[model samples]
Target: MKHADIKMAAEALFNERHNPLGAFSLGSETHRAVTIPDAVRRCRWIAVDINASAFGLFFVSPSPERARLVPCFDSDYPGVAVSTKFISGSNGEEMVHHTRDSTEPRWWTDDGSAAMNAMFGKLAWTGPMAPLAPGTSGIAFPVHADRGQCGLVVFTGSEIILKQDLLYEVHARCFSLFAAVARIRPSDAGRAHTISKRELECLKLTANGHTSEQIARTLKLSVHTANQYLTQSTQKLNAVNRNQAVAKALRLGLID
Candidate 1:
């Protein structure tokens, strides 16, 4: 699809009032949605997993399961632990929690990290999904706004082989729409304690290579107060220093 066409389609997908499950439920009663096949015909399977809690499944040409919602933390899937961390990274989050031995011997013994790197690389390149094997691929793209709740889109298929360009286009379009949605949604509801809006502003400026003095001047705060905010934010985010804190805040959506 042309860039303009992709942009239009993404806008439509983002505006469509669907459930948190994502594009997989396009035709369902919950929300007016867009069917994945209409956008990318070559896709054989589609699944969307969000926040490592909910997952929506879709298959265009059929597979083991036509469609389902599976829990992400289920231990039934051996390699899911490593894969989940990659997903967290893709969504710009730092650190993922997994139990000890969540890494299986059989799975880790067979070049698992290399495989994970390859898979995450493709996810970075192709969007958020990886092939179950050659010719069989899946894609999951996160959906969220700049200051809103987050979700995802997932697609998987085994019948049709997708082109590299088309895959890249799909990935980019999905992420763009996801970001738009994030802007419109409310801030995450479960946040226990958030950095004050002032603190976030300071961190965002700092992340853009601003000095504490610059940030303080920009925010109309004294240098000492600016430094205090930075130190407090860094501690809350568990960052080692100002630079690391800035990076972590951005990654955690604690700042712009």
Candidate 2:
């Protein structure tokens, strides 16, 4: 498929109005499920990983060799070293398997198995393994639908060779699409505002009437970084200045 066509398809896949829990169902219903082959045919990758935590959902294609996911736990493989937590939800667990060197094929080793169990919790449900052939690589993108539920679409194979910049762009677009879908609120619900941790810190200091320079010093960042955070918060809040940014942030419950 052409690059533009792939992008359009990806946007439509992610932007569907169904709840996050329905991604897997959509995959089954649509007849054109997103998978490793799809990713490689359209983009480039040997494998992929997608997951969601309370902080936010992310889909990372061409993830590190050892990366994996468990939908039931809403977690990733070898959970020990990672800093994120799983988002609580009811979707059954899913896992994506990939290889760095497909020609010299190797299945999941003991370490890999152990890591999967540890990250997903012993009792979590597991999904089927998607294999990659020789000379290929893969990428996984996580899609967060709603209610802390999520799903993954993995792309793999050696057919498409991708550059780092292109891969990053693809994943960035994927994340943006996922976020847009995830932000839709139910009519009767009181939606919670979200700001990245950095944005929250900046807003808190701004609310205290700290100058950008002062906030930067306190946060151990350059004034430019502090200003950038404020700017982002202002944009997120649709506000005009530091004071308005803080007020709007508070009103939106973006910061405690």
Candidate 3:
């Protein structure tokens, strides 16, 4: 697809109005059903559209003193470590470095020297996908959010490639997905707002499709007390009922 076309599709996917093509949209149901997992599942199309064989999302903390990264999600590649070393590793350092240092999109390939010096072969994108060694060709898109939060969405394939224009546009889509997920999963500080441990447990059970009685049995609480906890949590979250409360709590990262 053209860069402009991809941009429009991304915007449509996150628009507030319900989109008829539910498969392509995250805002189709007023965002009530939106969750971090759901967002990741829906955005997998990025890799699919580009024919990438591997896809991964990493949340990055770019503090020079303690640069760290956490894998938020991945697909098409199992048992692969998308850890801090993966980002700072030789073949990857330049791509991720450009991202963290300048917040730019980068494409990379191992030059055979990476395996030798571990840092000598680090190079910038010079053209379309070149004949790359296995496990070395990929595009990294930097996503910067408020409060110094940032992430990298990486797409890799045996012979994957990207044009300069498409690189920027695809990065925009990555940013949109990241922003949507951040809104759904609030910061840890926000977790302290309300909802006691017991209340959260009840809500989590409710989210797992358990009945109040079942939750009571599992937690060894009276059905009345279990119901009360659910009610209090629902009220505190400003939700209309247990189900809505569970949804809100999930969005707020209060419950898994």
Estimate TM-scores for all models. 0.32, 0.27, 0.48
CA lDDT, every model vs. true structure: 0.40, 0.39, 0.57
Clashes of each: 15, 23, 0
Candidates sorted by TM-score, descending order?
3, 1, 2
TM-score of 3: 0.48
For TM-score, the strongest prediction is 3
Q: Which of candidates 2 and 3 reaches a greater TM-score? A: 3
Question: Best-fitting candidate, measured by lDDT?
Answer: 3
RMSD of each: 14.9, 15.1, 11.5
Superposed Cα RMSD, model 3:
11.5
Tens digits of lDDT, candidate 3, 1-256: 4333443654554353332223233343423335755655655766766666677776553323223444566663334444323553333444444445554455555534333222212433322332212445666666654444566787766445454444544565676666555555444324325567788888889999999899999999999999999989878777788888887665444555
Clashing pairs in 3: none
Write model 2 residue lDDT over 43-110, tens digit each, in one string: 21112222221111223212122133322111233232122222111111233222111111111112
Q: Which residues of candidate 2, in runs, are more than 4 Å off? A: 1-194
Give the C-alpha miss distance for residue 79 in model 3, angstroms: 6.8
Residue 232 accuracy (lDDT) in model 3: 91
**TM-score (C-alpha, index-matched) for candidate 2:** 0.27
